[model samples]
Target: MPRSAREPGRATVQVTNHRLARLPDVQSQEVAPRTTPGSGPVVDVEQAEAALVEHYPRLVRLAYLVLPPGLGRTRRVLTAHALVQRALPRRRASASVIPAQAAGGTDGGGEDPGYSLLRLQVLRTALEAGRPPKRTAWPRRSQLPPLFPQVWGLKLFPRSGGAEELALDQQLSALSGPARAAYVLRGLERLPEDHVRKVLSAAGVTRPTAALREASRVPRQDALLESPEFDPCSLQARPTDLMRRRQHTKAALAAAGAAVVCGVLLAVPSGGWGPDGAAAPGYAQNPAARAALDPAKVTKVPPTAWRTSARTDFSVWPARGGLTGDTALLRRALAVWSRPGGSVQVSATPGTPSGAPAGPPQLLYAGRVDAARVVIFYDGLRLARYAEPARGTDGAALDFARVDAATGAEAEAVVLGRADGNVRYLTAPWVTKAAERDLLEPSAEAVDLGLQDGVTAPLAGPAEATGSCSSWNVLQLTEGSGIRLLTDLGELTPAHLTVGRPGAPGEASEPEALRTWSPFACSLAAVRSQGVRSVNAWEFARQTLPDGSGSAAWVCTRADTWRGDGPRVLAQFQTPGGRYGAVAAKAEGVTACGTKDPHVLAGVLWKSAEGRWYLLAAGSSDTGSIRATGGVTGSADGNLLAVRAAQGAQAGLKGTLEDGRTISGLR
Candidate 1:
């Protein structure tokens, strides 16, 4: 076996300064005495506030990756903020905890306060979220959202049989709460290994890297061998009693073939893992689908768009639908796209698409399926548009949906907002509903799809008060056209229609990715509820190789906001013999509903008898989650990729990336 090659390229740095016009007031307050040296000078409200200024954004992202995607990005961001506030050292309790094990609390100082705060914030938040709500059903491992891809540390497929990347996240979900904390701190946060070992001791994990090491039970070149400079931090209090209790629990996880640390149970079965809760009997098998897929056969398609080629001759559409929240604005929207040779005449329709029995949508669009947004479609085809509630009084979300002309399948596009307020597209085909069930939340019958775009923002507002309309505004989408702002009841602004664009990639624009990721996650969940596809994706940071590979790495990331010279991502896979590069499955696109890909398998990399790498991408198909139980499981239905290698390498591009970067390619 060979040591996995990890030569990071040079990544460009993006510098942006946010003027915290006003920060939280750092009011002076009394503090309680502490029993341990963890106590410190009263938390400098000014200093802590500054920490928020510097690390707040990253924390928000960490929160998204640390928490469940089922919560929806908005709530996740809010929850993260809440966790940061609660964990703040402003009070005696918070203050004590901050210094207790912060980077250098015991010794009276920390190496990185901001990072320490971030690590602590995420740990506390994850612990709280991981704990089942008063009697709520325990969240199974499959239900846990995927960890940020960075944790996998997998670039071009480290190995086959799941040891490389897939196994890490899966195994992490099953570890005891404390072990997870250690991995997050040591691995994802890149904290000193010794510091992580100490933290694990608190949570009662004897072997900080036991789960990860076991998950990667491979040849000599395993994760443990990758680094050796870390030592466990000295802990004043050890969790002896906790470990004893865990020892008394069952040693073997009958359900999942995993080693529990102090009684931590995994959510998977002993066999291979799959979407939904079904056991993947072929868990150890890799089809090497990459080799089967031909680059010529792979479609050249864009990730997202607000335009609709499928014509909608109907005059009416489903206020929750468009910009103005009025019928008159529809005319204006129609007029904007009307050109010399093209005529656009669309009006507000009073019913759903083609009168398809509009009793009520299976899943509420925004809690009320009755419909507040506008829609435009023809026959079975439909395109729904509406605005999501903004954070606080500030609205920051707009949803765009369109039906497939070929499949008549309606799905929404995902867009993530960059730091510069620019929009980055995430995986398309986000689901809103599947029959009578909503896949947005945890669903036993659904695949429970999860996404991590890593960024979010509030909706945009008019530059100048437009006749003092409501602070929040709705948006509209027309077939064959793009998005528009319904600033007024009958007005549309800057009427620039797009074929498949999410406005500009800067501030003052819709955080389309945030809006897109939430709903798309729902679709992914629904599609995977019964579990159809799952695959590996990778992202690399900037570093110079000994060889002459010194290109910038911003292609798969947002430059102005999260720009890096070479932080771009390249999706690929591994085989018994070697490794290869490729793209994700979701990028190719899928319908939100109907039996599209009965066996949709994409981007799954597997090995062959001869030891050749095979690239696989998603084939055409779209359908909602179908419950799989004891008698039958659809994990065999392909959407996973293990085909189309050689020519399937993801063409490295340069620019700001989006949630799609982290999204599972070839689903």
Candidate 2:
């Protein structure tokens, strides 16, 4: 075959060796410069060849690291050497030109002779020989491993297929000389535009316009060359086919035998019942019985009731009854009832009946009396006596009379003295007989009155003077309105109380009754019973006065409790603004009838004012229930109650408050 003419205006180099000739025309041009001796500068062809050989191994190693491993090692080494040999003469010529320029600066020498052209040649050889390999067209499908089922999977070819691929090449051929070279350099060798320009410049291929035009004409091959660096061995090792086959087989088996398996299991007895324990009485025959015995149908059994308590002495009493006992005794008994730590003492004095004898031998009262006050004594120490009605024997002075106990007679006599020597009597003139009658005897009735000055007086009567007295005064006042009493004692008391008239002195007082009293309030709403699985709603009302303005009316209901785990009592009070204030309580010392110290979950409090609701308090009770279980769980708001249902199992109850707030786990 006649050799094709080298492209016009493109650099060409003739090669002497048959091996070199058989290679591409570009390769021949690359290698020809090194072989041509003395054409431009005396070239040491042997030295260039030796240098290429010497650096070949390192070039191959570099290529291996950067290029795909599919390129065989031997081919890489050979290609490196060939490339180096081709590049040597071009670099040497450029290096020699530097000295030539310097010599020309001095005297315009015809050619630079001092430069070691051979050394330059060797360096250039090394560089060209180490250059990366040019990209090739898509390899044959047979060359690919079976693991790469898709030919385009390697991404080494344009996705446009063969027809479009030919069209792209034709477009490149119509470009000008420099453009064609630029296109060829960039497309074939995959060099960047700047790098191609640099390489061509170094090789004395200086035609800027042509190179740029050629670069512009080159079709973008990045789309074709961007292949996944896949390893054939890795793909071959995957179990894709096996996995698909197994999945298909599993699906087929399931579809084929599903009805048969279900039918067989359904027909067989579950072995769950009967007198002899051979089979269930109704097993598969009765639908309900079957369902009950079905293993897969099992579900959690929620707790029927929750009971809990703490070690508190306070007890809220129901509203129906009045307390019985010595008032003082009752107060003392109940005072320390809710206190965790307390003590009590009683003592009596042994003394003379009348008064203590003024002597050294007198004994003191028995027992300790610290922090105690004397409340009562049985003896009297003062007396009062009245004048007798009788005339005296002397005429001038009306006789002062005295009554004699023995005769029961009124006799005229001189008044010896008044009892305690403090009595004084005066006679008044009577204008009429009716006045004398009135003067003779004053009315024996006494008015029951309170001191308007706010000074308190001691009350009479044994109960008032002696036992069961509260620390605070318990007043029973009978006035025009009705009989009413005020005391600082409670249990099941009202949640809120209001007093004072509007626009009056110290008017309008609304105090939270439960908190102000000794014993806290308790409510029956949502009260849990043993083995009951439902929650109940109870409602109650409390009367209250409006604020200081006194123009509005207030009515309150039982809100909710603050404790999450314990029994919670809640009451709601309505304000003039149509909003409600709620109060809640967690009775610490309460439990179910049979159980001891069952954990009572805390309750959450919610208050609504002016249509907006807010959480106020979180109440809690310590029920000793979790002691048996290993773990403990609690909520942030203190309302969610947690308990171990069984070994390693937990259960919780939640309660809802107003405004979408909720308290849980009352058990």
Candidate of highest lDDT: 1
Error of 2 at 514 (Å): 26
Candidate 2 lDDT over 272-330, as tens digits, reads 33221111122334555434333233222121211132211111101110222223322
User: TM-score of every model?
Assistant: 0.21, 0.15
TM-score of 1: 0.21
* Ten-residue stretch with the least lDDT total in model 1: 554-563
Off by over 4 Å in 2: 1-239, 242-547, 551-568, 583-667
Residue 532 of model 2: what lDDT? 15
**Once model 2 is optimally superposed onto the true structure by TM-score, how far is the C-alpha of residue 40 displaced, in angstroms?**
85
